[model samples]
Target: MSNIHVYSEIGKLKKVLLHRPGNEIDGVIPQTMPRHLFDDIPWKKGAQREHDCFADILRKEGAEVVYIEDLFRKSFSQKGSREGFIKKFLDKHGIFNPHLREQLEAYLLCLSPEEMADKIMSGIKKSDLGPKKQEDFSRFFPEEEYEHYYTEPLANLYYTRDPGASIGRGMSFHCMEKLGRNLETVVWQHIFEHHPDFAKDAPMWLSNESHFGIEGGDIAVFSKDVIGIGCGLRTRPEAIEQLAGNILPQDTFKKILVFTIPKDRKFMHLDTVLTMIDHDKFTIHPGIEATLNVFEISLGGSGELVYKDQTDKVEKVLTKALNLDSVQVLRCADGSFIDSEREQWNDGTNTLAIAPGTVVTYSRNEVTNELLRRSGIKVLEMPCGELSRGRGGPRCMSMPLVREDI
Candidate 1:
């Protein structure tokens, strides 16, 4: 009866969570794109169109797609919950100005729940309040500059995968590395804790309160008893160890494989450089293979931690982990150095698998898509000219809530 159940990466996806691009996309101006972790300013309308098509594809594949906004709005229905959430949200973001915080809360409470959700996600500007309030505020602190937003837009919320990962019959909330993305996990945490749909039965294996940074994009549920987490860039070794301590003790999870990937933005998360496409196959960027470092963590007989340094290559390590004799890896752009680099930058390896041998990817990664097809994998391609501006692809934008056991 658990609301969350994701045991394998390539299982038939039953339910998924997504966030359609909204006014938040417009908030990413060129001046702040770097701070927001966006490569370029995305065209708002075009991004929405691409995201809609992506959701449509999942629906066609028999997966039920849920929106983050809808669930969040529903979570606010309980009496006093909306006000409580607003206070916590403002406090967590360092809205310490007493008068400003009070005015903001009163202003937000004036809106309906749906509108409040929209405004919070889109951002509330200082100008939105009347000039009289701004004048009074300036009198209190003359040096404080008038800014565009009192609450910055949650631009990266659309990439639903980063806030948390759904494990076997449970979920793990992440402590995001980037300051801008920290609250993204808070939003989902509130929903999963208050929303009637998930609050009653959903299990939260990890909380987002850790000082050690971890991201959902780096956590991969490879099989029923094994998980692969990347420890570089967005995910830290300490966080992985924390996750291991929590998850390995569960009966459903027996071991965890930690892979050390390049600590670069282009390869920020594990799914950005490698993802499972089929039962025994993975689509990966060849650039990561040369320096791949694998480690194993499991529970000891006396309920303590047992660690090992794995000397085998990624394929060999995966083969042993999944109890398969061999594992196949499909290289991005068929191993062409320059072409692979270009496609990889566009998220060629970040493919989302809805079934055992099928995946969804960006149509812009033509070379990688063709390679997948030739390798006997069904490729469902979606346009990404605008959506790719966020530097994530199909896998990066989705969080599978329920998947059929393989």
Candidate 2:
């Protein structure tokens, strides 16, 4: 019921949003897994159990958990609520032909609000919607071989962190580069713009119509006046500059540290390779610890961000930007190069800090979790056998909508 406020990544989380994997996971076939950005298909029942357990963990840690499905359902409770959302959902994906939109809308409206919401989240089969006279015949000369679902099941929606991020008292509905993920923003936009609880005062920083792309996993607000954004595979440097131009005039954050990392899928986002776990302590992957490109993004009087590329190392760059005396960096899977590579691939460097020193991570990363415990940090491990198939960890699965200001 309040405005979104997240000024620090390690602050005590107050409210968070997550999506419990449902029949949606069952919809991903082996043939379509790669196209949908999934490393492996997950068992639906087990995935739901894993997600429910994850939500319970957050709740026990004193955070209010809001399911994305529930939010959309609530937004649809009122009369005539489905009109705008349907239009937005269809148009955002370029399904603009009036006839095709009508068929989709009609199919969606027949069910109850909750069912309608679920159908959208679970995806739609082209066959289920019936033959569309409006269906494009130009591309079907040979008749597509695969059973193509009109709306791809968002198998990765469970990783809510990548689609959107919470900035200081606002939200950024990022324009994801992947075709499947672009729909995630459209779904959240409807909830934020129309849900009864958030409609009155939801502060949105970036629009869903943005051309340049920035995924939430790459952008982190470390403190009130200092922030860090990654320039990597999912998030381009141009998008970071555009985001800086949009955020600078607000003057809430004085400095933006652009950490450029390798574009390999192993280190797709900055948070995967680097994340702040406490005031002065950070979890790092050894692979990129010694090599990181650092740049300072700040406002110039000309209404654009003036970039100050730094020759200093990452630690020195952080110290300067965050005004820290000296920061401690803990490498993931310490000791063995092989173990480091293996553990980091399983998201060992990704930690969800509920409070300052207490965090949550996958238990499979034995060496990394032990390292976290040895560092005097509380480690809460969750079952990730089925959940990790989507290639996301605790931080990637949960998006803190509101957090206690540090």
Q: Give the winner by lDDT.
A: 1
- What clash count goes with each model? 0, 0
Per-residue alpha-carbon lDDT of candidate 1 for residues 223-261, written as tens digits (9 for 90 to 100): 998999998998998899988888788748899999999
What are the per-model C-alpha RMSD values against the true structure? 1.8, 2.1
Compute the lDDT of residue 379 as modeled in candidate 1.
97
Please identify model 1 stretches exceeding 4 Å from their true place: 131-146
lDDT of all predictions: 0.89, 0.84
- Give the alpha carbon lDDT tens digit for every residue of 1-35 in model 2: 35588899999999999999877777787888876
Residue 339 accuracy (lDDT) in model 1: 91
TM-score of each: 0.96, 0.94
User: Over 4 Å off in model 2, which ranges?
Assistant: 77-80, 97-99, 134-143, 301-304
